[model samples]
Target: MPKKHLPDPEKYELGEPYTHLGIPFPRLPATFEKNSVPLKEDYKMRSMDYLDTPEAYSLFEKQADLIIENGWKGIIDVGCRHGPVVDILMDKGYTDFNYMGFDTSAQPIEYAQETWQEFDNIEYRVMSWNEFAPAGASKGHKQLGQNNKKETDEEWWSRAGVKFKVDFHVDVMIWSGVLLYEPTYHLWFFHNMHNAYGAQNAIIQEPLKDQRAECWREDLELNTIEHRLHMYKTKYYEYESWEFDLDIFSGRRIISRVKLWQDGDSKWEDWVDTHGQLAANPHTEILPSGYKVIPYIFRGKLNFELSQRDQTLCQVALEKMFKERHSHRLADNYSRDKLHLGKMYMYNFVFDGDEPVFCSGVQNVTDKVVRVFSRYFAFEKYKTDGTTLLEKNDNFEELQYAMHWIRDRIIFWSRDKSPKFFERLKVKNELFSEWTVHPTKINIIYPNNEQYIFYTPKVPAEWWKNGNYDGFFK
Candidate 1:
């Protein structure tokens, strides 16, 4: 048997307390500093004019929409030049949010203050990032001296906090078009603004380095030492953060949305605290031909090196089975190259002694319809030949196992991200409509002054038609 590295919920490692770490400045190409645009009246006008195009302002508006949609109420917009976000908020008739916008350019700050003076919970100030976090502004981070003593990096960060110099706390921060200017400290500034600073949510949009003009790319050099998104590798399955990326400007720029929290409740959700439960909790079933199918869950990307052989075996078996059934329409597509063995999130396979008879997997997060575009394969006796004469070729029972696994994932994700966020998100299944999750629920009240508004979405036993597993839910 291949070595299995299943998740241990009790031992979920939270890679780091703060991922947005401090880094030294890079060697620059003199042009970036010697020839930079001045932050003045003309710059402010160009910024305001840039908003005239939907493409320019849509980024800001989307951030606003997400903030309101997700129930986030505070914003600390870095590089808030001329306050485009404030305008978008006011234009949308939204007055519930508290916004703090700061820019080094006095002209833009003055213009924004004068333009939106009467608004409540809105403030603009002329402040430099240097003033916010002196270490991030310079060529490198130096030991900060505090109380006449050299502060340790951890102590410095603790005392320092994202170094924005603000007294109050805001759960969300947005950085739009802000990285374009930081040339050297772009990622450094980025790491500090998002979850690295303890913000519950972060939205960042910036030009892609590869897409920038050659001259601009050479001048506005970003650090190659680390990537903004790659910083997330250590944080995934530990039940903390979930993220989504967006393409902007027809792929010229990109937007990264990062949320640094998930439900780890032991009562409603115990998966986070105990990953071992996933493997221990198997969905076993007996096929009509009396072949037993068992499902085992694996976490993270499946190490393809060990499973590559089984994967190919399943692929070849599937193609042969399909061809025998005269189903070339789909059989031709079951090539070994399409197994996608390396991308499994919650991986499941029925490996009987290093021989994979069945396999299926799905990613942790789902788009539009909280559903899975599952990758599954199973070995079956398509023809009545040899000792497998009683075997059914379709492997419908294995497919149902895959469906059950998908439902398990959807429930885990809905609870982790909050089921309310997925009200319109459906559970779609192309193969079997009976297994699909319907968008209806019946409320139940708890006794003794208690109310469980929990959305306990279920896959009713009646849907199975017959007790296929001989009381599987039992």
Candidate 2:
């Protein structure tokens, strides 16, 4: 089982320290100075594990294509561990461009420098963009050491064997998987890029808190409750692309495209209020609007299980069902033989005779309710005539059956013998109502007239006598 939280430095072995802004930070194992080549199993920067993934490779390919198509001359890859971006570009047969890579880690920088030593146009530095003082800052204040003589930013760049000016012109800048480490420095980093580098276009990618919810592994051996809390609290949402103005005085503007939890209203004001405070120099005016907020719904646990034979039949049905719709793919979690039966989950299924007509994988959410991930429905068969087997009303019936199944399972799962009632059940998507899945004749619980409606299902008095674990059916 994968660990539930980040490995503890004290308990587990760590790589060599990498300095950034004169401050030492630990690198991941296998990327240490001692390791000449990163281990294949290591998912850290040394082996460029991220790029090896199918999704990441596709993304990088597209990014590389974009850079080539634009005919960019000079490229600066911030946080360019092992110079993967340069390697990708070179592999694509683009060698005329000047490339400068920056990273806080000394190991990766050293590795990159040695690997690409033959290429004089390419350069790697064991430094962060944050190390450079903003344009016009005092030379003495920006000096690294007390013993060494003070030097201006230009002089420092010159001494470091690089010709960097206040207007450090670069055609394109790439910052991938860097911002998440220091989200507070977002504004400052952009400001510096615009002021000193005269950066025209910047491609940035960061893990958002909302989208990262599903990435959590529950199997980890957590040392502390705090680690669990941290895992639960982290949210991954969206990445932003920036366009810097050529003229420095005009400043730069960023347009952010955010992914919401469930198509809810964008919490731009909330983000601005929170993130703005952390900014080195907050730009309240630049924050854009009209972005939608993704809704986060509570997914109750699956209270029932099926026999292995029944499970196989259900899986086949689900695959066919999805094929008929041509909508969703069968997720690995559902198709896998092993199942993780736990609290806080939800599942959907419709049966025609002994075989399932439709099924949705059990959905799970973290305790913090920040992340939610689930597999889609699978069908057993598709209509050759290109018509759906179930009509609108039939679909409604199936949904009703599924809901009743949920209610019964919930009732059985509850310890209380009396009729159980819920204050409200909220769904952001209108499809829930369109599919006629919304429960009717339910009381309006909230005074504010919210979307959620009350539900009270009566359970038989004798139902509790059988005990909660009464197999899959009532």
Candidate 3:
């Protein structure tokens, strides 16, 4: 007799594929709206409305055409939860294209497969996006996907699934509105893109200016910035100073400073001209037609893989990553006989100590990895299973110490609070630890989660009270 723990191998346990066979398609709830669809008020059916939304339609059109035109063989919508977007596309008579939708949610995938069984070209996988962090980030986690109950919301997808491994080079990867709902995964999503097709092209539809206005308003409204600028403009005195006013962050001044450049009348014109492209002209008339010069860092391929060395390096890097991270461990219990060798696996990087560490998970494993990493790194958990032990750990002293370190190093980059200061840190090479430091402009062009760009730099005029990077030819 087989051991109780191992379970009888030859006993022929009723597996999911057989038991779940002939399971009827999910019916729209009774409370559903017209056309046999779930009600808009129902939170569970939130993914459906994206089909009717104008923005979603337009994005779909653009991506579909872009992918076809760009010679991309297919497209993958990362975090494609319910495949509603694809359904919409099919309804619109958009076919003859290659596509795959992945979600960590199994019932949804099963429902999708059952609902759209006619589409021979489409495929689905239940895996979290966190599986695609950098090489060293995976920290060998656990597995998931033991149970397979379609009716139960707490099935495999609801549970954390397997870890993912990423391969770059998708022609036109599109994410409709998934990122907004999962804000904390912003970095994780970008990290996956950067790793997968670091050199390939991508088009992400995200809210770029959504927070910029508020961020700017807070920067302009600070009294310290006002007073400091006034002092430098009038007195032309040099001093390093900071002021704090309670009642900001529950009686704490959250924003420390906003560094602005103040120049004398003669040099002011020169400064304005230098940054002309970034500013808007007050007068529409052709009175010099000045525009402010806005500095933006972008990531793109420096050159096509024209050079043999570049191609070789790309292959080598990908091979090393494939050999190290891809085990199809994430796809365990899913019939290895049918598994394809060309299948891409993406894994998340959980830093043991600020290093890119690796971890694996079966169906529900990625979710656990996400939770642990977020808690340990103080990163907000995006789409994962449970809370981390680190969060519940009652070691107040240790937590406080960690927060203090994070405050000085990480929190300082809170652009929401202090854009100017954060920008300063990004451009300037301030030593954080022996391992990590501020990245230069070049590094910003090829950014990863560990990398970020300086949206705004604090250029306190006090620093140039006399003159520095200010006067022309001086």
Tens-digit lDDT track of model 1 for 363-447: 4433211213234444452223445422324334554454443342322221222343333233332233323222333221112
Error of 2 at 295 (Å): 59
Sort by lDDT, best first: what order? 1, 2, 3
In order of appearance, the predictions have TM-scores of 0.38, 0.34, 0.28
Instruction: Summarize candidate 3's per-residue lDDT along 1-474 as a digit string, tens digits.
Output: 111122232332212221112221122243423432221222322233323334234434544555555555445666565565565555555565556677666655665566566665566677655443322332234211232222232232223312322222233455543444334334344433433331123434332222223122222221112222333234322223232221111111111111122322222222221122111111111112121111010011122222454334333433333444333343332233321212211112222232222221111111111001111111222223344422222222222222211100111121113243434433453332211222332221112322222221112233233322111111
Scored by CA lDDT, what does every candidate get?
0.44, 0.39, 0.31
For residue 13, give model 1's deviation from the true position in Å: 54
For candidate 3, give the lDDT of residue 189. 49
* Candidate 1 wrong stretches, greater than 4 Å: 1-44, 134-169, 180-198, 212-227, 232-251, 263-474
Runs with alpha carbons beyond 4 Å of true place in candidate 2: 1-48, 134-169, 212-214, 218-474
- Give me the candidate number with maximum lDDT: 1
> Which regions of candidate 3 are displaced past 4 Å?
1-43, 46-56, 84-96, 134-169, 181-188, 197-199, 207-474
